[model samples]
Target: MNSFFARKYVIQGIFISVAILIIARLFYLQIIDDSYLLSANNNVLRKVIVYPARGVILDRNGEVLVQNEPVYDLIVTPREAKDIDTLLLCNLINIDTVGFRKRMDKARAQSPYRASIFEKQLSSRTYAKLQEHLYKFRGFYVQNRTVRSYPDSMAAQFLGYILEVNDRDIERSKGFYKAGDYIGASGVESSYEELLRGNRGVKNLMVDALNRPKGIFSEGKYDTLAVSGDGLVSSLDKDLQILAERLMKNKIGSVVAIEPSSGEILSFVSSPSYDPNLMVGRERGNNYMKLLNDPHKPMFDRPIQASYPPGSVFKVVAALTAQQAGVIDQHSTFMCPGYYSYGGGRARMRCTHVHGTTSLVHSIEGSCNTYYGHVYARMIDSRGMSGPKAYDLWREGIMKFGIGQKLGIDLPGEKPGLIPTSDFYTKRYGSTKWRSGYNISLSIGQGEMGITPLQMANIMAIVANRGFYYRPHLIKGIGEKKIVKEEFTEKIYAGVDTKYYESVIEGMSRVVNQPGGTGYSVRINGIEMCGKTGTVQNPHGENHAVFFAFAPRENPKIAIAVFVENAGYGGTWAGPIASMLVEKHLKDTITIPKYIQDRIFNANLLPAVKVAAPKAKDAAKVAANTTAGLPKSRIPSTLRINADFSPRVNEDNARVNPLIEFNSQVYE
Candidate 1:
C-alpha cells in the first residue's frame, strides 16, 4: 500500500512539472521569437529597386558611339487593379483585349499583390496617352528605363548588342548584379565592362501612418548616388571608317589600316555590317539572327578570326629570311621557266607564266613564283637538310615576324595560325625521315601555313619599319588612361637583320614604282609604296584578291591589307583596292586615273572558268595558306577581266527609311 501511494505522488509531481515547462516554452515563443509576426506584417510593406544608367562609349575624339535614351514600361498588379473597362483600356494602349487578358492571367499566377511588366518600351505617343489617362487603369503604372542609342548610325561588330538581363545571367553574376541590370556583351564594351559599368544608387523613402510615401528619409542620407561610367575613347577615325564601309559595299571581305610606325589601327572595315542601334533593346536577338543568318556572314570578325595562307605574300617573308641567312642578297637572281624544278625527286612547281631570270627586287616586282620556289628549296634543303629540317629555319624566321602564332593582339577572337615546327613534322612523319621534297609548296607561301588579314597588315608594318612594328590596337583610351600596348610600343628587332628587309623593301617599291611591278597599275603618283600582292587561290571556284603595302617609302605612315573574294589576280583587283585606300589615307582622296578607276569599277572578277577540285589525299585538311594566282604577264595575258557587272542590290534592305522604320519606329 505504501509503494502504491509513493508511485501516485511521483506521477502527480511529474505531470505538474511538465505543465509548467510547456507554459514557459509558450512564453519564450510569444516574447522572444517574432519571425511569424514579422513575416505577417511584411505582407503590407514592399521594396522597389531603381536601376542605374549604364556608361557611354565614344571614339578617340570623344564622339559618342553608344549612349542611353529614356523609355517607359507598362506594369500591372492584377489584385490591386480594379473596376476596369478592359476593352477601353486595351484600345487606349493599342493592345487587344485578348492580349491584355493573357498578360493579366500571367501576372495573377505570379502574384496578385506584386507588380509585373505587361508591355515594355512603349513609344512616346503611347506613353503620353497613358500618362493622361493613368487613373482610368487603377492598378497599371509606368516604370522609367533607358535604352541604347547610336548617332552617325553605323555598327562596328565589336560594339555588341545589349539586352535585358535574363535569369541565367542574374544567377551567374550572383551577388553583384540583378535581372534588370545592363551588361556589356562584346567589343570594347565587354573588355572594359568593370570600368564602364558605374556604381548603382539607392533611395529610401519614409511612409506616413497610412502607408503613403511622405518624403525621402533624412533627404536620402543613406542612399548611394550612381556614378556614370568612364567613357571609352577608341582609336577609330570616323571619316576613314565611313569611307571604308561605303567602298566595301556588297563585298565580302575586310580592310585594316594602321599607322606603320605606331601600329594604331585607324580603320577597321567588315562589310555587310548592321547598325548598333538595332542591338540596344528587346528586338536585339531577332536583329542579331538576321545578320547572323546572312550568307555573307557579316557577324564574323574576319580580320581577327579568318586564317588564310599568306600565298605569295609569304614570298616576301621567304625572301627576307633568305637574305638574313646570308644565302642570298638583294641582287640574288633565280631563273624562271613556266615551272620551277625541285632539286631531287620532286614535282615541278607550275607558274602562271615564265617570269624570266629575276633578282630579289625583281622577284617581288614581278611576283615571280619560280624565284621564290628556288630560294625556298635552296634555303631549306641546302646542306642536305631534311624538308622538316629546312622548315625550322623558315619557321623561326616566320615567327619573328609574328606569324604562325598569336601576335598578342588587343582584339578578341584572334587566332594563332599554324606554322609547322620540326617537332610537329617529326611526330607526323618521323625524325630524319621527312625531306624538303615533302613540302616544297611551303617555300611559295603555300602548304600548311595560315594567317589572318590582321596578321598580314602587321607583317607589312614590320617590313615598312624595316624590322620593327607596334602591336595593332583599336582603343586609344578609356577616358584619360590610354590603352597602350606595352609590347609593341617599344621597338623590337623581330630578330631579323635590318639589311635583309631593305632588299625586300626595294622589291616591293619596284612593284609599285616600276612598270614591271605587279602593283604598278594601281600605284599612287605622289606616294612611293613598297608592297606585295597575293592572288590567294581558293578551293572555291574564284581566287581571292589580296594586297599588302605601306606608302611614302622612305618614311612610312600607313600600312594596309585588303582581301576581295572571287576576284581574279591580286594585282588586278586587290592591288587597286589597296592603292585606292593608300591614296585615301595619304591624300584623303582617290588619286586613281580615270581609266584605272573605270577599270576597277567595271571589272567583273567572279569565276570566268571553273577548275575541278583535284582529288588528292584529303585536300580538305590542307594547310590554310591562301592560293594567289597572278595575272598572266603582258606577253601572254589572259583576257583581262573588266568590271561591267554590279553587285546584287536589295532595295528593301537598303537604308532609304531608317528614319521612318528605324527599329524603334517599327519592331516595337
Candidate 2:
C-alpha cells in the first residue's frame, strides 16, 4: 500500500507540472509574442485611406476658375485577385490582357497583399459600367475621387496643376502621402498646397479569409472624418484675364496687371500657354511630355521666370535715383544729337530719336538714351567715393523699387532678376580695370541688368502709389470666413521721397497723352492714362516690345506691364495691348481702333523651335500603353496646338474661344 501511494503522488505531481507548462505556453502565444497576432490581423483587417476633395479656386468676382470633378480609380489587391476573368476584366476597362498582366506584375512588385491603383481617372461613363461588374472581380474595387478641372481656359501657369506623388514626395510627406496620391506641382497650387489639399481620413475594416472587405470594423469605431479643403478667393479679374489672353495669343512673352491700391494681381498671362485642362486627367503625362519637349517652353512661366533687359524702363529707375541723389532734377538738361559720345568721343550710345535739348520730362516722353546716359554717369559720380561705392548706393536705391530681388509674390518659380552689385563688375573687369564708361549700357536698361514682367508691373504700382506698395499676391481671402493675412494687407514703403514721384508721374503721363510722346498712338480718348514703353535690345533676335502703365492720373486704380518677345518696338506691339487692357479693366470695354486690335490678334512671334506632336501611330501606342483603364471616349485628340499657340491642324479646324468668356455662363 505504501508503494502504491508513492507512485500515485508522483503521477499527480507530473499532471500538475504539465498543466502549468501548458498555461505558460498559452500566455506566450497570446501576450508575449506579437508577430503571430500581427500576421493574423493583417490577414483579417483592411485599412482604407479616404482622400479629401481639393479646394476650389475662384476669381475676385466669384467666378470659378478651378473646380473638382469626380473620377474613378480601380484598386486591386494581388493576394485576393486570383481566378479573375482576365479577358472580361481587360475588355471592361478597355485594356489588352498583356497590359493588364503587366500592371498586375508591377503592382505585385510594389506589394502582394497591399492595395494599389491599377487604373486611374476613369470617366463617369466608364465608372458606371465598371461599378456593376466590380463585384465579379473579388479583389478589385472602384474608389470615387476628384481631379482638378478648369472652368475657363486661362491662367495656366500661375494656376498650376497637380501630379502623382513620387518617392521623394512620399518621403517628404511624413507618411501623409503614398504612391498614387496627387500633390500640387507648381504655381498657386504648390504655394497653397496645405490649404488646398485638406486632411485625409482612415477607416478600419474587417476582411474575410480571402482578404475581401466584409464591412466596417466595430461600426467605424476607429474611422476618422475627411475634411474638405478650404476654398481660395483669388485677386484675378476674370474679364481682364480673358482680355489679356486674347491680346497675348500667338505671342511669346508675358502680360502682368496689378491694382495699384491693393497690390492685387489683376491679370497674369504667359503666352503659348497650354490649356490648363490638357494637364488634367489620364493624358497629363503625354501632354506634359509635349510641353516639356517644345523648344518655346510654354511650361516656362515667363512673367516671373523670364528675365530680360528692362530696356528703357530702367530709365525710369535711373531718373528716380538721380533726382533722389541730387545728381539731376526735373530742370536738368542734356543735348542729344541722337547719341551720347563717351570715351573721348570714340564710344557712342545711340538714341532712336534726336531731341535737341532733353530735360527729365522730355527724356522719358521721347525715350532719349543720351539724357539718361548723362544722368546715370552723374549719379555714379555724385558722392566723392570710388565708382564701386557710388554704384552700391545706386543699386541700393534701385532695389528699393523691388528690383534685383524676389517680390515675394505668392507664386512658385519667380526669378529674382539680376541687379548686379559693384562687386559683380569688379570681379568681371577686375578691381582696377573697369570704370562707369565700360558699363554704360546699364543706363538704358541693357547690359547685365535683367528684370521680369511682373517686377516691371510692380515698379509701375510703386510709382502709382507714390512710393508705397503692397506685396503683389494672387490670393485675396481663404475659406468661408474670408480670412486674409495681415502681411498681404500691410503697406510696404519704398524708401524714396514722396515729393519726387510727381515729377516722374508727370513725365509718364506725357508719354501717353502728349502729342509728341512715343506712346501717343496708344492713348485712350477719355482716360488720363500714364504710360511708358521700352524696346529691349536682344542680340539673338528682334528687339522685345515692353510697356507698363496706370490709368486716371488722380487716384490711380490700375497698373500694368506687357512684354512681347522679338516683337520690335514697345510702342508698336506692347503699348497698344497694355493700353487696351487698361481700358477693358477700368471701363469694361475696349474702344481702341479695330485695325490695331486686329494687328495684335493676328501676329505670331514664336521662335523657330516648334514642338512636334506624336504621330498618329505613336499616339495610338501611348493610348494603348499609358491609358490602361480609360475608354477611347476619354482620350484627348492626339494632334493639338503646340506652345506657340500654332495648331497642328488647318486654321478652320483650330479651336478658338470667343473674345469674351466672362459675365456669361455660356463661356463654360
Candidate 3:
C-alpha cells in the first residue's frame, strides 16, 4: 500500500508539470509574439510591391537621353474575386472576356490566395479610367511601374532595350527578381543594369471584405519607401551621335569616335539602325521581329561586333612594329617596282604606283604594299629568328595597340577579332612548311586578320596619345556624385616607345595635308588632321572603304574610325565622313562645301532587301550568303557583305574635284 501511494504521487507530479508548461507557452505566444496574430489575420492583410523609378541616362552635356514614364499593372487575387462583371473588368483593362478568363486562370494557377499581374503596362488614359470604377471590382488593384523612354529616338544599339525577366534571368538574380519584372537585354542598359535598376520596397495594408484598401497595416510600421535609381552621365555626345546616324543613314557600315585623352566614346553608329523608341511599349515584340527579319540587319551592333580586315589602315601598326623591331626607320628605303614579288616570283602583291625608293613616311602616305611587304619580310626573317617566333612577336606588338583582344569597353557583345597565332599557322600549314611568304598578306592588313571598328578607333587613340591609351568607355559618370570608375581612368601603354610615333604621325599628317597623300581630298582647311585611308579587299563584293584619324595634330582631342561597305575607295566616302565629324566636333560647324555633305547624305549603298522569306532548309544558305566561299573562322558569322550591290557615285561631282575621283589604278 505504501509503494502504490509513492508511484501515484510521482505520476501526479509529472501530469501537473506538463500542464503548467503548456499554459506558459500559450501565454508567451499570445502576449509577446505578434507574428502569430499576423498569420491569424491573413485574410484581412495585403502585401503590395512598390517599384522604384529607373535611372535616367544623360549625355556628356547633361542632355537626357533616356527617362522613365509611368505605367500601371492590373493585379488580381482569384480567391477574393467573386461574382464580378467580367466583361466590364476586361473592357476597363482593354482586354477581351476570353483574355480575362485566361488571365484569371493563370492567377489561380499561381496561387488562389496571392495576387498576380492580370494585365501589365497600362497607359495613363486606361489607368485613369480604371481608377474611377476599380471599387466595383473586388480583387483587382493597380500597381504603378515605369518603362524606359528614349526622347531623341536614337542610339538603338548603344542605349539597348529592356524586356520582361525570363526564368534564367530570375535564377541569375538569386531570388531578387520574380516573374513580371523587367531587365536590361543589351547595350548600356545591360552594362549598368544594377545601378540603373533601383531598390524595390513593400507595403502592408489592411483590406475590407470587398478587397478595398482600408489603411496601412499596423499604422505604417511595415511600410518601406522606394528609392529611385542613380542617373548616369554617358560619354556619348548627342549632337555628334545624331550627325553620325544621319551620315550613315543610307549606307551600310559603322563609325566609332573616341576622345583621345579620356578615351570617352563620342559617337557610335551602326548603319541600318532602327530608332530606339521602337523597342519600347506593347508593339516591341512585333517591331523586334520586323527588325530581326529585315535583311539589312538593323539589330546588329557593328562597332563592337563586325570584324573586317583593317585594310591599309593597319599599315600604321606595321610601321610602328617594324620600327620597334629595328627592321625599318624614318629613312629606311624599300624599292617598289609596281608590286612585291615573293616565293621566288611565284606570288606578286600589286601596288598603286611604282615607288622607286620609298621611305617609311612615304610608304604610309602612298599606302605602298610593296614597301611594307619588304619591311615585314625583313622583320620576320632577320635577327636570326625563326619565322613562327618572329611572327608571334609581331602579333604581340600589334596586340599592344588594342588589336587581337577586347579593349574591355563598357558595352556588351565585344569580339576580340582575329589575329592568327603562329600555332594557328602551324595547325593549318604544317610545322616547318609555313614561311613568312605564306601569310605576307598580313603585312597589308588582309588575309586572316580582322578588326572591329571599336578596336580600330582605339588604335587611332593610341597613336594620338603617342603609344598610350585609356580603355575606351561609354559612361562618363555615375549617380549624382559623377563618379568615374578607376578602370576607365587608368592609362594603358601600347608597348611601343614614344619616339616611334613621330615618323608615323608625320606620315599620317601628310596623308591628310599633302597633295599626293591618299587622304588629301578630305583634309580640313584649318585643322591639322592626321589620317590614313584604307581600301579593304572583300572577296564577296566591292572593297570596304575605311579611314582612321585624329585631329589638331598637337594635343589631339578626337580619334575616329569609319567603314563604308561596298564603297570602292576610302578617300571618296570614309575619309570625307571622318573629316566632317572632326570639323563638327572642333568647329561646331560645317565649313566644308555643301557638295561634300550632300554626297554622303544622298548616297544609297544599302543592299537590296529580299522580298520573300527564306525557307527552313534554305536558312543555312541565307546565313552563308554574306560570307560565301570564305572560311567560317576568318570572319564574324553575322557579317553581311552585299555581293551584288554596286556603289553609285555622282559623276558630276567627281569631275568637279579631281581629288575626289575614284581611280582604278589606286589600290591600297
Give Cα-based local distance difference scores for all models: 0.70, 0.83, 0.85
Candidate 2 clashing pairs, residues 3+ apart or interchain: none
Candidate 1 TM-score versus the reference:
0.78
Q: Write the per-residue lDDT of candidate 3 for residues 1-668, one digit (tens) a residue.
A: 99999999999999999989988889889997655664446446887888989899999999999999999989887876778988888888778988888988999999987789888889899999989888788778788899999999999889999999999999999998989998889999999999999999998988765557778889889899889888999999999999999999989999999999999999999998998888877678899999999888999999999999898878899999888888888889989998787777765666778888899888888888889888878878775778888888888999988888999999999999999999987777666455667787787787788999999999999999998999999999999999999999999998889999999999899999998788888889899999999877666667788999999899999999999998878988999899889999999988767898899999998855545545767766776776677785775423433333454433111110111122112254
**Model 2, residue 475: what's the lDDT?**
94
Which window of 10 residues has the lowest lDDT sum in candidate 1? Answer: 659-668
Write model 1 residue lDDT over 491-608, tens digit each, in one string: 6667777778877888788878888667778878888988877777554445678888988898898898988777657887778877887888789899787786766655553333
Expressed as tens digits, the lDDT of each residue in 1-668 for candidate 2 is 99999999999999999999999988998999754664577566778778899999999999999999999998887866767989988888889989998999988998977788899999898888877777688777767789999988789998999999989999998998878889999989999999999998888888654445688988998999888899999999998898889888888999999998998999999988878999988788999999998777889999999998887777787888788888877899999997776666766666766789988888888788889878877877657788898888888989988899998899988999998988887776656444567677778787778889999999999889888899999999999987887888989887778887887888899989998788999999899899998877565656688898988888898999999998888899999999889998878888889999999988888766534667766866665676677776665444231224322221111111111111100000
Cα error of candidate 1 at position 9, Å: 39
Candidate 3 structure lDDT: 0.85
Error of 3 at 184 (Å): 1.5
Off by over 4 Å in 1: 1-50, 75-117, 123-125, 135-140, 166-168, 171-174, 205-217, 343-346, 383-386, 422-432, 481-492, 594-668
RMSD in Å for all candidates:
13.2, 11.3, 9.6
Higher-TM-score candidate of 1 and 2: 2
Q: What's the distance in Å from true for residue 462, model 1?
A: 0.9
